[model samples]
Target: MRFFRRLMLCVAPALLGVAASEPLSESFDVSVPQLPQIVATDGGKAVRYELHLTNFATVPLAVRGILVTDADTGKILRSFSRRPLLTHLIPLSGTRDDPSSARVTIQPGARAVLYVELSGPLPRRIGHTVDYVAACETCPLRLEIPAVAVNQAAAVTLAPPLAAGPWAAVQSPDWPRGHRRVVYTLDGKARIPGRYAIDWVGLDDAGRTTRGDPDRAVDAIGYDAPVLAGADARVAAVRDGMVESASIARNPDHVLGDGSGNYVALDLGQGRYAFYEHLRPGSIQVKVGQRVRRGQAIGALGFSGDTTGPHLHLHVANGLDPLKAEGIPFVIDSYTEIGRYDDIGALGSKPWQSAGPTRKSHEWPASNVVVRFR
Candidate 1:
């Protein structure tokens, strides 16, 4: 009996099975919704859609693939899966999770969001569906998403304006801070896999100071905030479960360089991808092969990588490869023109934030305008 008991203990993991080889029966609560009107000029137009998936069981589960098809012809339109550049897993908390592992696990009652967009002339007709293979510790299962169409468009106005204020320069040693004189030119175009700016509630404020204060106001600001989808696209890469850093202060333990903490990369189609980095641990809200819409709630911001304070760092890149991708130029919808560090004309300017004062002299925008097309 003693020997049998020991053998059972040794075989427990095998009996329970590993995620890779096991199949389970899983139920999903899923939905598809039409998006608001999206305007474009010339030959460009925008169509938006969203997919929300929730796990109803207590055990962990995995979703392997999702596909979109045209309901009229039963022909496949777009395909999404666990690809290197087009798959992601988000937690119920709306945070991005890491995808390096073999399986995606969602706790009981957890939810994930998938936003999808098709740009260019609106399709004559469209329908969307998902293909998912999920498993628990002991069983594996497969699911086919209910087909839905992208036939409706709603009216939507531009977003609200940002706050206005005087631009105050914060000085940093190696990082670009306040303003400096540099000759730079904008790219004639923007590409997928691009990077952009993430404005923190407190860090990017025109009048706020993030340095050299005992109060550490910058540290006081929480790292987690809603991260909107920069562009319309299907869900791409998502990396979660990385531990969130407590503060941006230099830590000797971080010397080895772990890339952005938890992150989400969205494929804007046409070889363009947008990456949101330094996400809070376990805050992801989407899954692999899922679709996402622009300005949708994806995840919260956090300081998890090479950062000194809780500020969002956004830039555009060209390729899906994070290491090899090149940064691109992008414009926010709106921003105020505040005072400059070295320019007297910009001094005491109300409700503006200057990009810098050294290279070019420009005023920030006022608070009431939405940052559009920038």
Candidate 2:
């Protein structure tokens, strides 16, 4: 907390006019590895980031809640607590299964991470107010940590990989398993390559993901759909001849470290690369060093890698390796939002409730929304 308190000397307190007698605040440490980046969403703007916390106190402490506020104005923007907070908090050290308590409770010398996603408009600077239940009587209940500046950098805008389809923009806010939470370590460095990733699962006219036999790859609506180049760039990496998953029930873990089966990485320049993963066997048309135009067919969507069904796993990253790189935000040039699915289990069978074909430009579709790229 000494480090945190020293950094926030110029920032406003969480409770204005109320001095925070942070007696025990100096016993703990908190930080953010990768700062929050503002991205345009279908509904509005959103900031997605994480908070890493370490406990130095001799006793255990339970995090009560977390509040996000405008740093300059001291206006409360969003708050999380109880079940909602527990769902996003993850214990990075010690045992995960403690029947008496949750993983959010930071044990002495243990570390944890808090996943946060704030929707709507926000200021350039933000502050965090964290409340904790400590064992010591001198420990203050609240600590205000500010100086977290929001990255207003514009997201890389690209063309849709699939030329035409009512694609279900599938994603979940669940941590420890969601694309946003999965991290990979390569060369002794960890990175989240799927931080802003999306699985483009195509839907048929009837709003079904597949027809005939669901287990067969040939029946999947997205199977063999032409995958296009998101931008005009040189091919940095290419992999092919990956055996497609015979059944939707198959797991690619047996293949080991081949999650991005038969993929292609395009160099988007400026330290950016676009990865198109889970492509059909022998469908990759470009080779390494080949420059492709936007909207050019690069491959076909197929059930490969760590997949349950046929879909295109597309994401932008800062490196060439699919797993080693850190994921970054990318916006579609133009797409029409048609409908949406609230539940993942009901994706194919349940028809999507239609909405006005909202023509969204230079923005990424929100999770579970249906968008048509034409």
Candidate 3:
């Protein structure tokens, strides 16, 4: 699959056939990869798609609302405003009231992602054509998407791609809707719909991250810690020598240019790939085209690339390129639930409550829940 930097806008010839000008005409563009038709676990017909929104103007654009409807019947299937039940089916970053209260802003030349879900047992007939309207302050845009044919093949089941180890989940999908950091991405492609992804960091008994010092990249815990291969795999890609961004306000060009700095991409057979990002400069031990086994050390964790601090950013996707692939769910072999923090901001000082049990089978650790490996 190819990655797109920006979407192209094509106006229907019927709309005066003239190229749309600034303000509403050519200010933004939207595209959907494919409309996946599937039967939800609830036995309802489901359609899941992600909208890639790009702003072409020089100033920021405030997105007021989004409305989706059946093009033939004009029946509104979902709206960010009226239908709370159906609209809630999609995992949007902000609250329901956000559209009118405080709309989402799209920075100049930046992109935004909106995952939408339409499901119900009643609508036995799926609409072949879907229409959507995007409400913004300066101009409103509408799109008519021709639904692609459905793929009847069964969904692929996923397995854990990591070794058993004590780790803390950060910006994880398991977190509360608004608090989930993985939902936001710089390129608008990292937030894959229906798939679980997470950022991990190591921790000690004192709640302090194992390695690095705050504000100082080198002093941070987990710095230079060994990064183990989650499963037997072939090195699909490797990148190194990218400079680290020490502060939260990173250089946009570097951050967006080389997202997974000094990293490794492992193809674990099938179509799944394990991505380990932000490794220490010159610390990568595996090269592209190399073969590795489960639990093998591939590299040392570092603060390299578009990171504010040192930590291991790992995710399993359907393809080798993380940002362009679909994120998939997986479980670690085994781990003990240690404790969880009440407030992540008070990381080093917060007292953790003892966890209840341990799991030996495949399962995802709860957000902010601490876990230890045997």
Clash pairs for candidate 2: 1-28
Please give, for residues 1-374, the per-residue lDDT of candidate 1 as tens digits: 00000101112334467534332344567654222234331124554344556777665445555566655676765666655213333444544436664434556788654545445545445554433434333333545544454435321221111123222323211122211111122244211222122333333343333434413423433345566676567777887887754444552244322555567777766555566776766778987678877677677666666555554444334556443453332333433332333432332232343343222112122111212212
Residue 296, candidate 3: Cα error in Å is 0.5
User: How well is each residue in 256-369 modelled by candidate 3, as lDDT tens digits?
Assistant: 547668889888777878788888888889989999887788888887766656778877667767576766545565566666665667654554666655553445555567
Q: What would the per-residue lDDT of candidate 2 be over residues 1-374, giving only the tens digit for each residue?
A: 12355222222356334575333233348777667788899768987877777887788877777888999998888777766667777777644534344325788889777788888878898888887766754444676785688878888889988977889998866736879987676789656788899999989867798887988887998899999999999999999997886878764573546888889999999999999999999899999999999999999998778888889999998888888887888999999999888777788898787897899998877888888999
Better of 1 and 3 by TM-score: 3
Cα error, residue 140 of model 3, in Å, equals 18
Q: What is the TM-score of each candidate against the true structure?
A: 0.39, 0.89, 0.59
Higher-ranked by lDDT: 2 or 3:
2
The TM-score ranking, best first, is 2, 3, 1
- How many pairs collide in each candidate, listed in order? 56, 1, 8
lDDT to native, each model: 0.44, 0.81, 0.57
